[model samples]
Every structure is written in structure tokens, then in C-alpha cells.
Target: MAERSEEVKLLGMWASPFSRRVEIALTLKGVPYEFSEQDIANKSPLLLQSNPVHKKIPVLLHSGKPISESLVILEYIDDTWQNNPILPQDPYDRATARFWGRFVDEQIYVTAMKVVGKVGEEKDAAVEATRDLLKLLEKELVGKKFLGGERLGFVDIVATLVAFWLMRTEEVVGVKVVPVEMFPEIHRWVKNLLDVDVIKKCIPPEDEHLNYIRARMDRLKLKSV
Candidate 1:
């Protein structure tokens, strides 16, 4: 096995769920990389230069070549490090994994963003839409341990990240979209995800995240008022 180059670096935000996805992938693959924390509000020069298009964190720099976008970076990581592969080997399984991953990116991500940023009827609609999506996810996870089955695969990582953010957004909006009783499967999945050693270490402290969301909600309320 070829040793991964030491020059790989990850530019990421501390509290970003997107960045957490990349971090988990790297850890699961046992790929060593330097982590540079970025303040998205301040917009560090390196982050801006590395990701000129999106100016986002979770940028992967492999041997000086930067790759932006969390999903794109996950593909790059899987391709670069074949060991502890995140995607399935079979063609059909890989495709299925990709489909669920895209679903999280489109439906879950969009609804969670709306719930956190908007208010009034718009926010209510977004919350209800998110609840419906979570119900769908609960049904999908009925008998499966993870989105990609027993092992935590690519889709599981993407979905977990979205779920993490949605849970936080619920705190911010003073609403509960993914109530444990209503979505037992999702609740089980959340426990399974956090039980992983790497994920357990990577997730932000609960109180810290709650405080951050509360402050954000306060700011949003003030702006609206």
C-alpha cells in the first residue's frame, strides 16, 4: 500500500456539519491530513483562494491541489485511498448509495437551511416538509442498521450530517421535527452514528451547539422584529 502523502490539508469550519462529513471519511480511511480551522464569517485568505467559486470550507488540498465541495471531496478521498473504502464495490450498490446521498443533498439540506433562516409561514412549511422527509427516512431505515446497510457507507455519512444539522435547526427554531417517538428508526440511526468512535469524537459538544443555535435564533428574531 502506498503511504498517503503528508501534504494533504483540510480547510474547514469547527461547527460545520459539511466539514464533519469530510473529517469522518478521512478518519474512517485512516488517511492522515492537516486540519486548518476557518472562520467563515471572517473568510480567511486561504479559504477564499482555495475555493474561489463557493468560498466554502471542507476544502480538501491534496499535495497542493485543492478540491472544494464536501461531496466532491469525499469522492476524491475514496478514489485516492482505496483502503477502508466508503462506497460499495458492486455497481448497483454504488449507484444506490449515490442516489440516497443525492437525496440528502437536495431534500434534507434545503429544508434544514430554510428552517434555520426563515420565519413565519415559510419556516413553518419548511419544518413540516422536513418532518415529512424524516418520516420517509424512518421508513427507509425500518430494518436496516445504516443507510447503506450494516456498514456505515457514503450515503450514511451524508444523511448523518444532514440529520445533525436538522436537529440543531430544531433547537434554533424552537420546534421538534424529528421527535424520537415519531421517528424511532431515525433515532436509532442517530445513536448508531454517534456510537462510532470517530464520529463520537468529531461531533460538537451538545451544550456548545445548543448555545450557538440559541444565539443565532436570537439574532434572527431581532432582525425580523
Candidate 2:
């Protein structure tokens, strides 16, 4: 029998897509962990102690050793566990998957946040940038069921995180970067991704997420006024 340990801990925030990414990865791997919800605004002592540098949520602690960064944590989870493989076996395919994963971080997530956080012309520009990024993703998904072709892989995980945040931002900002008619491929991808049992259950309640973003946007609006 394999040695069973009970030392895995995940520090996360409810509204954070990064946190969701880590949670999904762990759940997919069937790794048992204790989840500690962190108040990012208040900053928990345990979170600060575990991730002294970034002091960010979504920190994974295995046997008391903490690891920060969602992508790095995903890689860690995939590498440490052998039962459910998240990455591809072929080196070239793995690199492609990693490229798309990084692309989601750099393009979709970065642009979507900027779009939601800005006002007037800046906000319009950000929306345009996000639309362009989504168009690119649409092209990428032309003939694929998932980013890894058939199965949900690393790139799919990253892309799903982007979609989750983007959807919330759209509700809060009262703008649609991903117009369903314009980007049929991405719309299809979003529907497919959300249909997955784990993802459907793992996503934060939609109304709750929307309310959270709306509150933040209202605060920003008040600050500007």
C-alpha cells in the first residue's frame, strides 16, 4: 500500500480565476487537500507565512512546502501525480499545449482585465484588444474539440480560466467582448468547457461572481465620480 499523507493545503480566494485554475487541477488529479479561503484584502497570517514573497492566494502547500503561481502549481500537480496525466506525452505536443496555456495568461486574461478596469476610450481600446485575442482563439479552435484536440489538457484549463473571468467582466462592465455570433468557435468552446462535470461544479456560483465584480466596478465608478 502507498503511504497516505494529509499535508496538502490550498490557499485560495473565491473570485480569483487563478485560484480556480489550481482548484480544478487538484480536483482533476483526485488529490485530496484542505482548502483555506483567504481574504485577499485582509491578508491572512497563514497565507503571508506560506507565500512570503508574492503573498498571493492559490498557494499550494504539500508537506508544508508552499508553491506559488497557478501555472507552476499545475505543473507541480501533474508531475507529482502519476494516475491522471494533465500534460501530453509527446514533447512537441507538450510544448504546443504549454504555448497556448501561456498565451491565455498573456493575451486573454491580461486584456480582459484591462478592458474591465478602464473607462471611456481606454476601455474601448481594451475591449478591442480582447476581441482580437478571442478571434485568435477562435482560429486556434477551428478543428479541435479541445486545445489538446480531444481531451481537456493544460491549455484547456488555462483557457477556461480566461473564459470564466471574461464572462464575469462582461456582466460587470455591461460590454461583450465575446459576441457569440462573431466568435462561434470560442462560444462553442465555452459551452463545451462549462459542460464538463468538474468544471460545472467547480465554477463559483454565477450570480455571486457577477455581484462581486459589480461591487468592484461600482467602487471604481464612485472613485472616479
Candidate 3:
């Protein structure tokens, strides 16, 4: 793979699933970039300048230009790299991919958050909602190996929250959102996503990631107390 001449920099936090999305995409396209580990709490000047509107990490700086937001950054990466193509060439297929990517953001992740640290009737209701949301995905995935069909695409990258983060959150909170028998399609999709080489490189070691979540949740609990 020929490296891009322009310097590429990624402003990201390791714990952020969004940042992980950018990392996976760059690795898949074999794009070389400098990773600037940002202290979001402190809000680095460069990070602020790059993403003034969102003031968020996972900003991709290609040459002197800045692209913010994980989803928007993802589109920019695909357009710029033009290799290993994250979205299918077919117009309808590309549109389908975009729709699902938004669904993951708007529906899946938002619904799953309701289950985190929630209890009693609220937790139960949230769990049910999450189940319903996942069922839609399970149906879509019935005849396909991946959400992206043959390759890891935009939908697969965006669904990292479902594939990895949600499972970790469930372990920490002891609320099981996905069970193998209940969500076989999601389970299979996750297994296939984990098997992807670029994904493996981007995901933090299981022990490290789990420990981080455990510590973060403990902090949250203390705050509530």
C-alpha cells in the first residue's frame, strides 16, 4: 500500500469507542498517522482548534485540514484513501450502509445506555427496548455473514459498541443485554468482527479494557454514594 504524502494525525482517547472506530478504519486502509493521545478533561489547544464545534476527540487532521465527528471522519477517510473501500460501490448498498450506521448511533447505542447503571422497573424496560432494537439488527443479519456482507464496512465499524463495548458494560453492571441464544445473529456478527485483523489491532487487550471499565464504573458508583 502506498502511503499518503500528506501528514495524517488522529486526536483520540483510547477508552473512546468512537476513537477506536477511526483507528480501525485507518488500519484497514493502511493509512499511516500519528496518534495524539488527548486529555479530554484538559482539552488540548490543538484538539479544540481541530474540532471547535464538537470539542471532541477522534478528529482526523489530513494535511492542515481538520475533520471532526467519528462518522463524518469515517466518510472523509474512505473518500480520501479510496482503497479497500469501506462502503460498497453500488449506490443503494452504500445508502443502506449509511442508514444502518446512523441506526447504530441513534438506536442501538442510545437504547443500550439506558440499561447501564439502571435498576428495577427502569432497567427491565430498558433491557426490553434494547432487545427489540437488537432484534431488528438480527433480522437484517439473517442471510449475511457480516452487516457489511463480505467485508468490514461502515456499519461494522459503527457497531463496535454492540460487538465489544456493550458486552463489557454488561459484565461490569451485571445486566446481560445480549445472550448467544437470544441474539444469535449479533453473536455471530461479533465473532466475525473480532476475527478481522484490523479490528484485532485496534481493540485494547481484553483484560486491560475490562479493568478500565471496572475502575470507571467504581468511580461512578462512588460519585452516586
Number of the predicted model whose lDDT against the real structure is largest: 3
lDDT of 2 by residue, 1-225 (tens): 022226788999888888888888878877788889999889999899988898888899998898998889988888887666888989998888888888889877877777755779999999898888878888999988877678778888877766787866776788888888888888788888877887886788988988898888788778777
For model 2, the stretches where C-alpha displacement exceeds 4 angstroms are 1-5, 223-225
The window of 10 residues in a row where model 1 has the poorest summed lDDT is 1-10
**Whole-model lDDT, model 2:** 0.82
The TM-score of predicted model 1 comes to 0.92
TM-scores, all candidates, are 0.92, 0.93, 0.94
lDDT tens digits, residues 112-184, model 1?
A: 7677657689978988888887777788898998887898889888886656777766766778878888888
Candidate 2: clashing pairs of residues = none
Give candidate 1 misplaced runs (Cα > 4 Å): 1-3, 117-120
Choose the strongest candidate by TM-score. 3
- Where is model 3 poorest over a 10-residue stretch in terms of lDDT? 1-10
TM-score of 2: 0.93
Scanning candidate 2 in windows of ten residues, the lowest lDDT window is 1-10
Q: What are the lDDT figures for the candidates, one per model? A: 0.82, 0.82, 0.87
